[model samples]
Target chain A: MIRDKLCAGTALGRRIADSRDRLYRVALAWCGDEMLADDLVQETIETGILKSRQLKDENRLYSWLYRILKNAWYASLRKNKGHETLDEELLADEAGPFSNCQQLEIVVQVRQAIGRLPAEQRQVISLVDLDGLPYCEVAEALEIPIGTVMSRLHRARKGLLGKMTTAPSGAMTANRILHLVE
Target chain B: MENTEYSLDDQTLGSFVDGMLDAAHSETVIRAMDQDQDVRERVHQLHLVKDLMKVGFGHTKAPSAHSKKTRLATWRLFSPRIAASVAALFVVFAAGMLSQPYVNGQPGFPGEMLAAFSPVLSDSDNVILHISESDPQQFAAALLYAEKFLQEHRSQGYQVDVVAHAGGLDVMRADVSPLKLQMIEMLSRYDNVHFVGCANAIRVLREKGINPPIIAGVSTKDTAFDHIVGRLTSGSWKYIRVDSLVDNPGSA
Candidate 1:
């Protein structure tokens, strides 16, 4: 029994370490802050290490782990007095690496569009697009019904498509058509 | 503007592109694409949105390599974003762009680095000073680096986070830290300078039957990596590994 528990613990640790980047990506997409997202992923991994037994099905581990991150983000939100987002002016003023570079500008536009999304929509989008978790896994991660996952993802994609269509910048439909056709 | 031969709602098209559709529904959409140029065009746009998303959020290693199956693999074969800037990965590192000048006799980022990386530095002037060594020289070097960076910067907004973990936890321990007085003085001197102890490290030490008391000025975090990640991603924070600053530390 002791050996089995130790083996299980070792496996869980490896999985947690492997999932760190994925968790970080989703957290970054969810909260829109690299630093906060990193901390959230670390906390989630730490909790997963300690509470591995709570997880009954290893197949659902990513979703279970993501649920912990979702809760941690919410806890962090509460700690900050329920400020879900930074002030738009404040966010606009913040500059990232290579902000002056042209390609970086397209990335900036994409991020700005995501920043404008409602938090729930943002969560599903990040899980789907960034983390590459399917609709079912995303639903499992956020503890929502699969239907909610699909709907939010649909709305999120619609929002992104709206941004692209309006801007006519970045790699949008027009740009693709411009490149695809003679 | 109407194609009577085949049609798909935006939601259905979005699902089909995302591989959320069942095999039968996906095949229907594929047939629609074969007959209608507009269907192909609209599907390409839906895919463009997802590709842009991956590029935007794929900051960590192998940005889009985590998943076992990617329905978008076909689109990647002809992705324009890849052609435009295959080298434009997220978060370009040019800390080397700065002169590794000496600050109070320790190698550190000079003030001129601020102007050199304006948008990245100007947005947030934060530094993380990480030390996990028990060597006295490395410890003193960290102290000097911290005090000098904070003292020399003209902007009061400049902030420093001292993260000590593993063997380096000794630097933040109340009974063990060699420069406890200096740490206390530094803490009192600058409001922006903060010291954090790793709770994970502390707990490990406790399990080993030695619970070293952490200094009063130092706060405890769940893990050092969490604190470090928070600092880096929260803003334009630079990381300084104490060991990298020196080749050999003099024994205590």
Candidate 2:
């Protein structure tokens, strides 16, 4: 008899569900497309369910899920590399075309700036800066070294600062800092 | 007392913002920031960038609640009702075994085994397409629809499993299916595409002294619908009824 208990109402399922938004956010930042990000998150959950048994440590649940999502993202990247682009249209509108609010504009700029970063830098930055994962955990999730994470994080931050601050001479430093959002 | 080892570089500043620095390094960074305007400015920039990134990308909406329930039900397949129902069915089968009048030494074949061994491939990312029509034209249209759907979704890691039974079994038979070459080609190209035939129907054909020729890559199960239902009850698979699409097999 097949054991149906593995995928059933286990603690792992609940934990995976709880981290859905976090996965989506990282996916959105990584791919810069809403629909593609949604697909990545859903695929990650399905894969996680099928292979949850391979996860040996329960304490590493979130990082384990992140690793799954990251691998899925890379697989997708490889799959679509030859014939198509990954969300170029999503990066086209960096000025918040859908909204007129000034506050949302900065968020759009930040998104655009982050989008322009190299993919490696973008991945590390989203995991660290956006998701607030610790350096070691981010390294573990990405399967990279801690020093690499730090170096990438530094470059990603510098790149974002340059794009946001050097946009034009229209705004002062104080106003920019005031507009900084949490 | 300058800590020459860990300078106030961008890497150190970003780590400081992330709380990723060791206690000693963090203390040194804090003291450096207190004494140096440049360090404070860089630290502020890192904080602003981090916060801005959070505010910008952290707002992606979670998937719909209905989709969440569907995913959970399909992936987990362990609702109390489902488990209880399966248990009750097993108990009923066992009771029937006891009530049956003894014949030869061998226990009569368990009736539940028929449903249990439906030859459904348990691949996680499956899409079941049901076709009950034996018309060559209908089969062609159904295959076309499936091909279109598979082309769009196959890259996204979905398996398109076709279940044919009763009159539909003709669609999987090598002699009868008009699209045999096409089916073979599809099976060759996409491992995720599957065609399953019902054994009960085959046995019925044999009882009538007629032999069935199944196509390559066409698998057989005890009951096609039973297997489909089992998979539907257990996993999040897309089930498509393609007869309606025969006339107007529009884009998938």
Candidate 3:
């Protein structure tokens, strides 16, 4: 029994370490504040470790961790009350767009387009399209019906098509395109 | 493979794009796409959207990935001392369990006792009002309704969070909102009230190279309605859509 318990604990630890990067990226996408994203990830990992025993099936670990991360992000939002904690000077030093000009432009355009989607649709798109989770898993994480997930993902993709295609070639940035659309 | 008349619905199409469909249904959709140009184009656009989203968000790894020391610093926040305390408590409880009779197990200590002593705060009332209108008159009407809401429930210790987004950003802008002074006064008067603007809306203006004057007191969220929806799903929050509220005042 002791040996089995040790193996289970190690397996849960490995699962958490494997998911850290994906969880951080999703948190950043959801909140757009780097500091808050870090806080969310840290809290998620800590909570996962503390409550790892409650998790019954090993096969369900992936969706279970995603649910924990989502709940942690929401709780942080409630506690902090919509505070912006992104350090501009720090971001400028690191992650301030790469030298690959065309690739950089495409990235900016896509990010802004995703940002413009309605909040409900954006959540579904973030999980399904960006994070590459299955539709059923996305529904489980958000605690919504599966049909709602499909509809939201459809609307989100349609919105992105308009935003991505309508931008002026070469000369205009995402904000100008967004302003024009508005 | 000759089912051209059987059109695929949005959910089926989306499921196909996400690879959630079974092999048999997936083959049917592919066959239909080959026969219909419209279906093919939509399937392609949906694929493009998914690819674009992946390129946008997937490549941007957290900066903490590069700094092991910084990651350790964050881990330190959880504290080994607290973990040790929890571990010690578990060991002591285990010893007590082994020493006792197996008759009932006595509700297993601490969690049940804590629950018995804890007060019920779940009965408290909360609400969220989302204002998505740019009209100054609408803003005034929404604020008036907020005032009435607080007056009725302030004695009961109710909480309210007001969120503004999209064209709603205008209501929180100092240069644009006609009720800017009134907003400032309301902020000072009500400790329970909060006004939040959408951060993505602000980012759009900044990226356009047009900086507008913004009011000082309002907070900025990643998305306004998403925050409200999160609260609504978790707890019993009476959600008042201020745009709709202004359209039908008697119903609100």
**Per-residue lDDT of candidate 1, residues A1-182 (tens digit):** 22234335487767776787778766766666554666687778778877888999998898899899999999988887544453221121112222122333355456657777888888888887777677788888898998778777777777776765565223334364334322
By DockQ, the best candidate is 2
Clashing pairs in 1: A34-B233, A35-B233, A35-B234
TM-score of chain A of each: 0.78, 0.82, 0.75
Model 2 lDDT per residue over A57-87, tens place: 8877767888888898889879767633542
The per-residue C-alpha lDDT of model 2 at residue B223 equals 76
Could you tell me how far off, in angstroms, the CA of residue A104 lies in candidate 1 after the best superposition? 1.6
DockQ: the better of candidates 2 and 3 = 2
Q: lDDT (CA) for every model shown? A: 0.63, 0.63, 0.59
Ranking by DockQ: 2, 3, 1
How many Å off is the CA of B1 in candidate 1?
A: 26
Question: Model 3, residue B59: what's the lDDT?
Answer: 65
Query: B156 in model 1: Cα distance from truth in Å?
Result: 12
Could you give candidate 2's per-residue lDDT for residues B1-252 as a string of tens digits?
Answer: 122343337777777788878899999999999999988987887788778776667654655645444543211221110000112323433454424322254322233432321222223445666666676544644554456556566667677778887788898888877667667767877777788888888998999998999998899987765556455445455454445344322212
Please list the residue runs of candidate 3 whose C-alpha ends up more than 4 Å from where it truly belongs after superposition.
A1-9, A82-99, A168-182, B1-8, B65-252
